[model samples]
Target: MESLTIRRPDDWHLHLRDGDMLRAVAPESRDMGRAIVMPNLVPPVVTHDDARAYRERIVAAGFARPLMTLYLTEGTNPDDVVSAHAAGTITAVKLYPAGATTNSASGVRSIEAVRAVLAAMEAAGVPLCLHGEVTDREIDIFDREARFLDDVLTPLRAAHPELKLTLEHVTTSEAVDWVRAHPGVGATITVQHLLANRNDMLAGGLRPHFYCLPILKRGRHQEALRAAATSGESAFFLGTDSAPHPTHAKEATCCAAGCFTAPIALACYAHVFEEEDALDRLESFASLNGPAHYGLPPNADTVTLTRGAALDLPPRIDTHGQSVTLFDPGHPLHWHIH
Candidate 1:
């Protein structure tokens, strides 16, 4: 093939922080096309006004069309849910278990709170994107995701059969099965989790940049993620979760949990699909599946990617008076956009 061309893809989950960082990084994602902007900002976007202002800022920074999400908080107004969605200000609401990940201290503290918002969202046909991990301190770090599924998500789904859910950055085989079994649910697999396992973070030494919430699992889980992502199933899609943190933050004692993968996300996903010998299905995983799941129109724009090329991803990006690390900083990618 001369070049692999597909509809311009939408990033189902992304974190483009405000101000200079957003300015510095927005273009990399805008160059791709629309993205579902996450709502875990410092104060957290919990209302229609917040989502609207945030969307304006993203547009002001030159993002083509950034979809919005509400950060589900305890005592969140169900009326706000209806207003946000009805106003076209938000595409979905995100539920981050309290303290589950970055800037999530304000996340819903219990399923009761989420149930209220989920009920409103279900009635309005809005999806609930979950950061699937339990915050209980007693749970093993690696077991949090599975525990959340068993203790929380499973029961929540049974109780609210009408709610549409998306399991974000799913890391375990059990998660894959959970999404597969539930017709009302879907999953977004990140490139980092699909390509690397837990050992990769400690392969030679501590690799903080590769660390993320719902942390990477064992190799068998990685294999399951690969199958789920490349199977061309509608229930699975691409969500880069390209969270960028200042380099100083990542190299510190307690590194931030994120991977700045936007610059190389397409190339990395191509590498994975090619290795699976499923390049023919790449468009669906990266482009088509997301819109289908979101009930939005697939992007009409197109991007061309050529194979057999080694592209260098910068070791770190100097932006907004801070340095940010690229996900696979020192690696050479096989695919390059032309």
Candidate 2:
């Protein structure tokens, strides 16, 4: 096929940072449809006011009605959930286990402290977006996500059966099974995990830009994610989680964890799905599934992508004295944006 058209896709989870970084990178994603912007800013988006202001900033930066998320804190006000939801400023509350990922030190130290907020969300019919990993130092890095499911999430789900939850950037087979087994739970599979395994980070040499939280897993897990996303399941969808960090920050001694995939996320996803022979189902995973899970309508606009064209993935985005490389800079995508 020369070209394919589908309903505009929304990024179910994204971290656009703030200020110059936000403005510099927002358009690439905006070229797609609405996105669920993460709330893990420096101070963390823990209040309705924070979410509202963040939404306003995103709009001011030229993003068309970006979906906003509240960063759940130990002392998050339950009333804020109602107010934010009522105002239509916050689509979901993000649960980040303290120190689970970037700027997550302000995340909930214990799930117990956020129970009231969760209850409010359940009552308000808002979804709970989760980072899904235990912060316990004893838990091996590779096993944290699975451990969180067994030790924390299982009980949390049982306790909050009414609450809607989404496991973000799920990388393991266990997460796939968990979402499949639970009717109320859904998930977003990131492009990076679907395309590469943990070994990709150190393949020919150490590649820091490929590093991300819930770091890439074994080939089996990569295959599992590919299957889940391309299966056209209503419970599975796309979330680029296209985190970007300054080049200096990423190339430093202890490089920050993130992948700058915004510039080429759709292209990469199209290539992967096409390779799997599931290109026909791309629209569901990219556009329809996420909105359905969140009880929103799919966007009316559409984007067309074409195959058999070469698209040059930028090596780096130079903004305000710093640069950020696009994720998977070495991979050649078979698809190109039209």
Candidate 3:
């Protein structure tokens, strides 16, 4: 097909760091219908007021609709969560499991510690977004996600059967199956996870650009992610997890983990679905499933992708005196949103 048109897509998970970094990255996502902004900043957005302030800044940057989230820290107030939901200030609350990812040092250390808050969210019909990876030092880095399924996610579902959850940036076959099996549970797959596996990070030498938390899994896992994303399943949808980090932060001795993918996210997703011969299902995965799962209406507008020239995008974006790298999908994309 030379062209495709679909409802404007929404990113169920995205990261726009505060201040200058926010200005540099937020505009790249402006074309999206809406985005669920992650709250893993240095201090993190732990209250309704913080989310409101962040939303204002995103709007100031010209992004149309920014759906904010509160960071679920051990100290998160259950009453505050209920009030936030009631006030319509947050779309969801993110649980990071402490050191699961970038700026997640204040994430919840134990589910028990946050049960009251979880219960509050469930009562208020607020969804919980999870960075589904275990932080147990004893667990192998590769096994953390799978272990998280058995040790944490599964139990949490049983405890709060009605609590809506989206396993953010899920990267394992195990997570895919679990989400598929559980009702009221959904998962968001990142563009990087769908396109690259572990080898892309360490095979021919370290490729720091491909490094990300819940780090890329094996090829079999990537295959599973592709199948789930293109299967036209409502439980799975697009979430770029387009986290941006300055070039210096990513190349350091103890490099940070994230792939700044906001710019080419949709194009990358198009390449994946086209390869699977599932172009027909791309809209459902990108634009429909997420809204259905979140109980929001699908966007009224549409975006057209014209397939004529190879997709050309900047390799890096410069702002705030630092450069943020863009994700290279490793294959030429002919689809360009018009």
Candidate 4:
């Protein structure tokens, strides 16, 4: 098949940094029906008022239906979280372990401290998106995610059995199996994870563009992600985790962790689905499953990916004088989304 059409997709996780960078990258996601906007901005969106205002700014930046989230903090008020979700000011609450990723210094340090908040969210039906990794200095970088499963998430899951959870940008074979074993948990797989493995980042020299938190795992993990995403599974869906960092920061001694996948997200996902011989099941991963997990109806609109000829997309997007690099899959992408 040369062309395929399906319901417009939604991004289960996305990061559009505030201000000029937000304006520069927001339009890149216009083809998506909605995006669960990360709230890790400076000062972070911790309250209903904060999420509402951030949503307004995102709308002004051209992302019309940004589903805003609150950056969960140890000081987070349970009442504030329930109210925000009930009022429709926020879609979910993001749990970023302290120092887990970029701008996550204020993340929850003790999950026990947030137990009341989690209970409130569970009582109300608010989804909690997790950056599932432990920050202990001893755990090897590659083993953090798997360790998080046994050490942190398992007990948390057992305690909050009724809570809605979406494991954001999951990158391990263990994580894939864990999500499958759990009945209602959802997982978001990114373009970088599907298209490249840890080898792509560390093989010859570090390809900083592929460096991201819950850093890309081994090739076997990539194969697991590919199989899970293309298997028409209900628990896995697309969330680009499309984080952008200025070129200077990315090329620095301590480069920031994220891939600016927003600009070419759909095409890259199409490329993966095509390679897996699962183009027919693309709609289930990209469009159907996420909404079902979030308890929403599928979008009314549609997008078509016409497969032919390599796309000549821009290498970077200019924000002020700095440029944010776009992720290159290191291969010719034949699918162009329209």
Models 1 onward score TM values of: 0.97, 0.98, 0.98, 0.99
Sort by lDDT, best first: what order? 4, 3, 2, 1
lDDT digits (tens) for residues 1-338 of candidate 4: 79999999999999999998988899989879999999999989999999989999999989999998999999999999999999989889999999999999999889999999999999999999999999999889999999999998999999999999999999999999999999999999999999999889999898999899989989999999999999999999999999999988998999999999887889989988888999999999999999999999999999989989898988888865658999989998888888
Per-model C-alpha RMSD? 1.3, 1.1, 0.9, 0.8
- How good is model 1 by TM-score? 0.97
Ranking by TM-score: 4, 3, 2, 1
| Local distance difference test values of all predictions, in order | 0.88, 0.88, 0.91, 0.93
Candidate closer to the true structure by lDDT (higher is better), 3 or 4: 4
Report the lDDT tens digits of candidate 2 across residue range 35-140. Answer: 9999999998988899888888887766877889998888888998789988998899899999999999998888788888888888888889999999889879
**Per-residue lDDT of model 3, residues 18-97, tens digit only:** 88898888899855899999999878999989889989998997687999899998899999888888888999999998
lDDT tens readout by residue for model 1, 163-227: 88899999999999999999858899998998899888888899998888878889999999999
For each of the candidates, give the backbone clash count.
Answer: 0, 0, 0, 0
Off by over 4 Å in 3: none
- After superposition, the stretches of candidate 4 with alpha carbons farther than 4 Å from their true spots are none
